[model samples]
Target: MTANPTRLGAIRTIEASEAPAAFFDVTEKTGAIFGENVFSLSVMQKRLPKSVFRSVYATIQRGEKLDPAVADIVASAMKDWAMERGVTHYAHVFYPLTGLTAEKHDSFMEPVGDGTAVWEFSGKTLVQGEPDASSFPNGGIRATFEARGYTGWDVQSPAYILENPNGNTLCIPTIFVSMTGEALDHKTPLLRSEAAMSEQAQRVLALFGHEDIDKVVSYCGPEQEYFLVDSAFVNSRPDLLNAGRSLFGAKPPKGQEFDDHYFGAIPERVLGFMHDTERALFRLGVPAKTRHNEVAPGQFEIAPVFERANLASDHQQLLMSTFRSIAKQHGFECLFHEKPFAGVNGSGKHVNFSFGNGNQGNFLSPGDNPHDNAQFLVFCAAIIRAVHLYGGLLRLSIASAGNDHRLGANEAPPAIISIFLGDQLQDVFEQIAGGGATSSKQKGVLSVGVDTLPDLTKDAGDRNRTSPMAFTGNRFEFRAAGSNQTVAASMVIINTIMAEALDFLATEIETSVKGGTEFNAAVQAVLAKVVEQHGAVVFNGNGYSEEWHVEAEKRGLKNLRTTVDALPEYQSPEARKLFTTYGVFSEAELESRFEIGLEQYVMTINVEANLTGEIAKTTILPAAVRYQTELATNVSALKAAGVDADTADLLRVSEMIAALRAGIGALDDAKATGHDHEGLAEAAYYRDSVLPAMLQIREAADEIETFIADDLWPLPTYQEMLFIR
Candidate 1:
């Protein structure tokens, strides 16, 4: 009935705030500043001696291990380049199990004698840096007392300079590992999986009559979606500040219902923020290419051009951090949490994936005549087989507490992992399954009604947004991955499973050819067998429908709905064998990951539960009581005047107040009672008990919000947060 002062103040703050000025000077062209801060191949070529540069370039281009002999030369060149740009320190940037970037900064200035100092970056320092392993989540890989962790230089991922107002730092992307050589970070496993996949991909290429092939690399172009709310609103709401999401907010009346926001005109304020982010990303060579409005109010997306998987993962981390910082300068808080607001379309990071080498193009691309493109069909068949055998692994890859709120919610992909081959490719695969494919579908032209308008070329197949993994032209867009998660984990699963499938197909085709069968016929036979066995995983229908759920179950698909359900797949025998055989993860490494995932899941729920209870008691409950007292006082006064008054409003408010108190108590009890179990059991306890308790608290709190006077509300409402901007 009344406008809350906090909400009104937030609106004023946002209205008064102006977009930041141009980040770059007019003299500096966008193309010129791009990759200027990076120690790229060109920079290396210009800095190092020809011989030394060649060796370093080999490592960067071909994924070869950096030679020890060339480390000193490379380090010297890097240090010189950094110092020229006023960089006093260098940090070994790594991705830990916490799903955030970690760094240990060391000053390059070393004291000489007599108060003199010289900038020094040694080969050993460049190659390795020590950070406390125990401080990071290592599962059981390292004991709490054992604090030794090493960050090793990944030469393939170029080093870049991070700018600051005071001074800059030269940041080298590295992989974190324990003293015993166990992977303690996301990057190590991703790099390992890439290597495994590349080896098998080359073998498949060779079988297709390619003589000399370049090192295959999996490429990723992740489309990131997020919500941007004014910092004033975020700062006022403790839940948003602490939990990165609104713990309890009633559904707004106008929340993405009309589909008007999707691909709508960009808001000027958001455009300025985007420009600032793009400039920063460009300097770091992130290749941020596309920007647009997303489905929900205040939600937006940015997609980078394709890059090598390792570099893309590193860039993705940089992009999130960049968005956060730049957003603040522009008076916004970028919310990367999936389902930051309920009853609205959530955010997702759709990773468009494809693998290829210099010698041949994308292995998944079925050319104009896909029906006769035996090599393409073989590669496509490989994916079908991979998804069929390891669909559970794919589902587990994207599993998280935040993602659980989004999956199968109509906005994001369902938990049941399946490939969506559009009609053209589906027909080709069906032909193969039946016997052999003879004809290919051709694209049709669309003629506009206006004489001035030229005819448009139409794609052979339509796109499917509902599918978890859809074939979008040459690449598969993994729409199931959460916007907040690191792209490395899902990529690791994709690369490793693809490697297994490629290895199997290569062996089968090679064996058949060696036994005096025609090469094309052998390929056809292998592909046919794959289709017959694995075609069930390819579903082009709406993945969101209930019929698909029943059909998926009938097809033997495992619908692991929650993180607790999906996480155990990490310990499965099939997972162990796939990782171990491919040399991506050792037995210990795999088990440690399982432990870490479960721990994270439980910890996430615990934090949310505590926040819910704390906010309800300290903020919402007090406000509700004040409003209830007001209603009771009014009712008593009206009755004392001898005039009839309705007690319905007063009674309703009183009932809600009681419910809120009870819910908060139950939530606190649930939070306090869930510590006895550990790992998966603990995670299950949180999911079954703590989460339900939290929802109960949220329900009561939300209902109280509707009854309470708006001026008496202590927190910003969802309508204000999502739409005010």
Candidate 2:
């Protein structure tokens, strides 16, 4: 006699209601509260002895080995600071290859015979610790029975306090390794790659007559995008909870079509959430510099200032964790999936990267006269050669189940990797290839046509949103990284590739100079060779266009359109040789990573398939049938009552009932057959067969959704979920 009304009703209530008033007071001075929870360099300087602090600082800055003699003093100082801040426990935090942060906490208190406790922290414990690493995904490095793994302190990232409702814990960033010494985590390889990259970069700098060059580092400033939805909406859909995306929702009636949502005013509820999130980030010493509404309803973006790649990677993990934890407190579920809702803009973490040592800033920066700036030209040429040689590996770095929904979607960059140097550099490089470059283009100032507004100095070129990698004024922005990923993989791959390319350039120049050739002639000769061989990867046009894709294939560029197509490339002979030669990864590690990527893809599709079959049978099929029966009953009653009624509704419901049954049967059949194979074959079955069947089911179910009355609909509509604020 009645239909349950909860999903839609809850959404309606939230939509019509105003946001809750602030439950807590906010501090106005952000600087006053900043770094309060972090054990930063300043804190270490104040707490440790002068000699110990200087030694530690040198190790941290130059990536030198930590001295054993100083660990005791440093540990004592750290323990005192943590205990003073009411911390009773400490954890060694590490990054596992499963794209997550891992930590095991230990208490600081040790009981004495006199019924008292003493807080103790030792240098050995601070430097290294053993954890049960069998459970972590090690890619066959350690068997299930062999569970030993080590965690070594990463002094580059600072320690910070993580608070719970009851207590706080000290979290020290560390690198995790398997028992056989293979890297079981992303940080270890990333750190190694950084060291290799810096050595080669130093040699290249010496050729340009720059002495006293410090160790170089790759910097990353990632811009994160995410969507926020009410917890009620998220929990109601089992697919969302299990798959981190909505597996079965019809396209919303109005979604991002007018472009009004981009840079739109923040909703009151969302503003409060942003405010609290930023304050928490600042306290953790995460330099979150920008936050704004993005190009879709309910989507937002947060960007931070650039930092060293190692610290940046750690901070990214902390940032994602912070977003999720804080979202729960605000009654929201933060969606980091590449595409949560259909027919809306997906989220991507645009990673801006560049390299430099302490003496010179930003080697990618094209100075006022880039043609005359030999140093910038050398580094820029190195990047071009690296990308051309390793474009396939770059694609593999971002391969994942979630990102497959975003890349090549027209709104984001295509699967093809290319460099977008601005017009000014493009012209210079063209001149260099032809013979030599002359003068450089300078930026011009423009008036706003109003006396009150000042004139703006516009850059020589505009930013390209459609390129996978675009050269911003001082950095290259990699726009294809999915939102949920750790930045380690992308940066590591970039560093290794750059290392190889830079070595090639340096060797050629060195040999030429030894042969009694002029240095200037040697530099120009190398640049000309680089442009002639590797210049095909540079493109300034729209990457999403059809013409570019066709032209790219003709130019011999790879178009790895999906994870399945691209993941296998990671084990290619060229990729393996590059990694091994540079000491970034061994062959076994490469094989393991490839296996992990394939396994993840297969499992992800399997879950979505199972949920699709179950939801269609348990929820969708019954709903459609009940509505069909109701319409039949009404039609029969009208005929018995001798009143004519429209037969159109009855016919419509019958068609949907038949389609739903047929779609569900097809999906069940697909899942039953696709499981017989393993490795790439099994992944292929899911991609080619099962995924298509799942889509068919969604198609029929969405058609049924359009006809069902609002009260009888089992799932919340996209309109309500997206626009309900």
Candidate 3:
């Protein structure tokens, strides 16, 4: 750790062989080992009797009740399979209200006669476990001394094996609840939401002459974007370690401005990390599909194939955890902060979602003649109506302190939740609303005016990256989510709201048909009504533009720009009513979540502010002043020697030092006021006032870094961190 200015620069361009080998171990029998590490459907089929397997499948597929008798047999089989995989312990993995995964491990060993040990896992153990609830954030749901909480097995999501340096263990996906049976985690509400949506969606299908369709599940494929910085750099930067973002680093002379990093070749070290992560994910039955360089330096993205929302969310958590663990082995740090760097593009989780039957038919798939596919149009209208009516909930679903820096920034989607129906769908909606006949259009060919990309057949609509919620060919990509978030929150909101919309549509259609209106005419009337009422949510313009904000206001779209501003919507009367009526969340549960969210917002900013202040005072200020003193001494020595002492740059550096001191004082004053965390109003005040002061200090310090001799600079720079493989 010698103070060499070029040490980081020298290592930045290391040869490919210098990096670790890609993790392709052909000796491991990948195909055979795939899902060998998971207690998946195949494992269940082999372990359980035919009757038990059928019962479990029914529960997973049709949302039917699990048979009490079958639970023991299923758990016994899962336990045996896990033991064969060298798993001595089991954990109920859950997602808490804090928006991160939580787990508590217990050994499978049970005491036998004569002090002998027997490895056993019982149905009771697999089905439920009690953990202390008071230790976790409950938003006043539980008292401090109330230590009772239950974790129930979520049979819908398959259990997976988690391997660590110490050992391997079985990880069962579970839903956490309070002792009094109140939802205490993100998963329980999500599962409830899924069930609610299925009930309503079945009604819609029944109206369409598909009475046998028992369940309709929403599916999601979230494209996760993240940054990987060298471990040494991350450890050296206190801001990043504490806040998961750079609080003071200046933008490198060369940032993403050249646009050379986007879709660039994957660096060898990063490729090794990705390989290892994908291998682990694949073993866990996660269908990880795409991996490639993203828009910023040291940034990459991975997308999985679509699956049911619950399973997808479970896999997403596993994927993120696996990435971090694998990165540690590769001597790197994976950063999921929405904006890890100031000048580079921030990370986002683009959630591609669609509804489908168990038979794998996507309901959103508009056939060649989208206008003629009335079912597709109806489903699409359901989403539009849901989004329009409950845009606040959708916005609140992705709200967080980390995301506050990314959303509404030029690179990411704006905070205003609007749908991008694309040109073709927009036209179809207009025609349907205007009571005009639908027209069919053939696919068009795309030409790049070059031979690189073959003339490929293109879909009817162009992709709009700027829109918050864009409808791709078959699914809507909800791009508002931060890279670090679990997919459960967004999925729950989408599923629940869509369920409410569909239920309304079904009721209206049933009334119309019962009143002697023809089926087609009634369907058309409902579509027209939906377009007239909720079409304002469909916006295809550039969401990043200021003009669009004004236009959105005219369109009556709610713009919730920050976590503090957006989180209150969770407790709104309309939102509470929507969730309660749909059986997604009780009013009490919704209120609890609102408090938890607001508290999280305040705590996140408070921690960041404190860390920024500490770093500036203890590390950055001393280094800058020491460098300034050296420059001043050199100027005086030159003057004494009767040389043409040119101190212009040195004087400029001195002025910057003064400005840095002033900025630090401002931070001190802001901290002393202690106005932050008073409530929502004060929390917003901190974001608007104190947070800006902290940034100002960072700006002055960053300016000083550029001027200081590289040897004297104490902290790692963006160039050092970003360019490193």
Candidate 4:
């Protein structure tokens, strides 16, 4: 007669929905709030002595080695700026190899002799921090007894003020490393790879008769996708809380099948959360540019304009943190797990990347007549060659256990890594492969069947959402990145591979020209050779197509289907050579990442499997048995009264109960077997055995969900969680 005790979650969620949202007021304009909390260049210019400020600014702009003498001055300026704004503490924030941010906060109040504290922040403190090295996942790079990990300031990424209800702290972005110089975090390799790529890019530019070229920094604009569910629903499901996904929920009758939710109007509660989150991001100097409903009912996405890759990666981590805190305030639990809900399109972080130097704009830009632009063609060829040579590494970069649920699902890219140059670019490459590119396709105006509206010029190339890497107008959007992953890994791999490819092409061009071939002729020959050898990696067709998978395998392109399959490629001889060549990651550092990834994959699946078994035995089974009892008792009475009673309901319940119990037993067995295994073998066991058992449990549990009464179902239904306010 009454709602289940677990209904408290739903009640709380409803109440939260009804509560009025607190608004963030933007009193003036972009100039007023923009970089308000950030220790930006403008902030430094105002606070520091002009000479010191310029020294720091020049180092940042030109990628010069940091002057140790200027560190004290900059730290002093940074400290003064923070203390004036009521900041009492500073945190050296670093992104560890675990794809998460780690920070160590220190007090500014160093006690003086008199029982009073003096606000002191020195260059030594600012430049270096030592956190427990053994605590973080290091892929066996450091022993447990080894506790010396260092954090050094990444001067390119500006420090920012982080606010809490209680107090504020200044956050400095830094790179984490081991004492032996192995990268203990993502940022170190990212910065090194950027430098390597820039050096080669400069060489290529010099060939094109350019002199004023600053360091080429990769720009990243990641569109983040996530699901939002009420605290009530999230609390009711242990799977959502523990595993970050619905382990046993059945598909809603009306899921995203109608495709109505894609780009739909935002729900009021969710919209308010987005507004507040964007406001907070703006104050942190993040340029959030887009937000909208995603394909699934509860899914949403937010994007920012591209920033330099290193800063963007740091901001991305900060943005995810912002989403969690801001959504909680609005009574929503943000789910960054790739597939939070089964039977719906999952999430991804589509990383649109392009690189640029000081005045030379976007290097990836293949202009109107791409064939005529030899410089653009060479750059484009570098990407084609890079993707071809290290396609496996590219696939490896985005692989993870969470992402396994999303990729190859039609909604996302296939496991096969390939480039999509669109029709226009693909054609040019085809022509170059045959001999040389001559003419290029041009954009034409579209009337849109309306006279009042101005005619629009359609892009020469249509967008392909299914492609893992697609060349948009000016950038290659790496669409396969998991929503929960750090872009640093992907960017680092991209930079290293591109550096190798660029160097290889430059050498070929130089050798040909030096041998008395015309400069333009040498460039054409190199592009032709690159395309002829690597063009198989470029496919503009639907990557989701079965034929493409077959063709890809035939073409010898690697299809790294899971984390286990992809991670081993990270330590391949070619991969080691590429990273080492660029000074991005040493052999030890790269192997360490491989080890860490393997462990993470094993750990993630083991947890999910265990949670699946626990939830099935505890939450789901109890509900099923109670409902079965009611159905059985009623049927028995009808049978005793000599009326014919259908046994179908009882039989179905009995079969499902058996299946559920069987799944739980199977998963338990699988987990035990997985634990007994070692290294990649253990990860393989989880991917092969453990995942199947979990799926079996989910299948039976989901079936039982349909038969159980609404009130008897303890957890929130997919219907209620996805559609209810």
**Candidate of highest lDDT:** 1
Using Cα atoms with residue i matched to residue i, what is each candidate's TM-score against the true structure? 0.99, 0.97, 0.96, 0.98
Query: Of models 1 and 3, which has the larger TM-score?
Result: 1
Least accurate 10 contiguous residues by lDDT in model 3: 8-17
Report the C-alpha lDDT of model 1 over 336-386, residue by residue, as the tens digit: 999788899889999899999777878878889899889888878888999
Model 2 agreement with the true structure over 46-156: per-residue lDDT tens digits: 998899998899888887788889988888888899988889999999998889899989999889999999889999989998999988886676778998999998888
Clashing pairs in 4: 9-232
* Candidate 1 worst ten-residue window by lDDT: 1-10
TM-score of 2: 0.97
lDDT of each: 0.91, 0.89, 0.86, 0.89
RMSD, one per candidate, in order: 1.1, 1.9, 2.2, 1.5
Q: What is the C-alpha lDDT profile of model 4 across 104-216, one tens digit per residue?
A: 99999888888987889999999999988898988888999999999999899999999887789999999999998888999999999999999999889888889888888
Looking at model 4, residue 172 earns an lDDT score of 99
The sequence of per-residue lDDT tens digits that candidate 3 reaches over residues 172-216 is 999999988889898988888988888888888888887568588
**Best to worst by lDDT, what's the order?**
1, 4, 2, 3
Best by TM-score: 1
